[model samples]
Target: MKRIAVGVALLLMAATSAIGAGYTWKNLNPIAVGT
Candidate 1:
């Protein structure tokens, strides 16, 4: 049970990082296009 909890926490962290990267890319893309 503890192992399963740890696995889920890792998955959540990975997903959050992906979302953060995508959001950063989206925010930067418009400036890049404008330039």
Candidate 2:
């Protein structure tokens, strides 16, 4: 049970990190284009 919980937490962290990176890139593009 402890291992499963840890695995789930790691998975969530990775997923959120990936999502945040993609989102930041998306937000940056328009500013880059405008410049």
True-structure lDDT of candidate 2? 0.91
Model 2, range 1-35, lDDT digits (tens) per residue?
99999999999999999999888887889777567
Error of 2 at 1 (Å): 0.7
Best lDDT goes to which candidate?
A: 1
Reference-based TM-score, model 1: 0.78
Error of 1 at 16 (Å): 0.4
lDDT of 1 by residue, 1-35 (tens): 99999999999999999999988887989787567
Kindly report the root-mean-square deviation of model 2 from the true structure over all alpha carbons. 3.6
> After best superposition, candidate 2 residue 19: deviation in angstroms?
0.5
Worst ten in a row by lDDT for model 2: 26-35
